[model samples]
Target: MLNPVMNNTKWYELRLQMCALVPPPTWSTFSTAGYRSQPDREWFYHFREGGYEDILHVDIQVETPVEREIVRSALKAVHVPGEETPSGFRVFGYLHDGQGAGYI
Candidate 1:
């Protein structure tokens, strides 16, 4: 069996950078009321799962109204260029994925 793999190591870097924007304290209710931020592997799959070829698409779901601005600022602070969307931001970059080396 083959496992999904992100070909670009930069994506990993970007994930960490972006994840840092959201402090650990607020991570409990960052996304939505019941949704927790999976700092480890959450953001990485957005591009591959959504079929986005040239951008890092992240959907920010806020538990409160104030989180909107926080998310906006974080999106701009990310390393790559990104545009705000209704649900989140579309970070312009190359985030491709493919099957990892299959088991012998």
Candidate 2:
């Protein structure tokens, strides 16, 4: 069960944080802020073991080159490693670059 008030407040906070992090001209819009269920067997096992198990996906879409670069840079600043290729997007754990531990 989700608490309406708490969820709404948290959602707004997240939206603001994202807007600040990406700013204008970099993130045209931020959408799909919601909760997701945990994977099947893992969820069941966690429930049985009285442990916490769940995951949330924060999805955003970027449109322009400037926006894409801003997002990629921001992720890198936070040590969130991402790959840039002529193909498409990719996400992975943060990897440090030579610059005193920055994302790669």
Candidate 3:
């Protein structure tokens, strides 16, 4: 059984660390602080097995050149244990169990 509190905390810390690692360049459309503040505009989706898996499976549309480049770079730099598919990224492990994988 997964501990919801611990799972959320791990994912939150991971996301925050990733946001810190790849600070959006001045020329980019969004700021790291802004991105951190707004969950809707999150760089990646985090989920547990059998819980809203659809969020991870939805296609993320990167409209502009800047956005595309940033997304690509972030995905490459931020190590999320998962496979990137045509539809979306699929995470392969659990957070609460000390497994690295969590966010999509």
Query: How do the residues 25-94 of candidate 1 rate in per-residue lDDT, one tens digit apiece?
Result: 1211122122333533345344234333333233344444456566656544544444545544444332
Top model number, TM-score: 1
Candidate 2 lDDT, 1-104, residue by residue in tens: 32111133343343343455434222111112333334222211232232111212222345577766765665444443234534323322122243122223
Off by over 4 Å in 3: 1-10, 17-39, 42-60, 83-104
- lDDT of candidate 1 at residue 72, scale 0 to 100: 59
Go through the candidates in order and give each one's C-alpha lDDT. 0.40, 0.34, 0.37
Q: Tell me how far the alpha carbon of residue 9 in candidate 1 is from the true structure, in angstroms, after superposition.
A: 6.5
Candidate 3, residues 1-104, lDDT tens digits: the string is 33222234444443454455334222111221222112233434432223331222223334456655565555555454454444334433223455444343
Question: How well does model 2 score by local distance difference test?
Answer: 0.34
The TM-score of candidate 1 is 0.38
Better of 2 and 3 by TM-score: 2
TM-score of each: 0.38, 0.33, 0.32
Model 1: residue 25 alpha-carbon error in angstroms: 13
Best by lDDT: 1
TM-score of model 2 (CA atoms): 0.33
Evaluate model 3: give its TM-score: 0.32
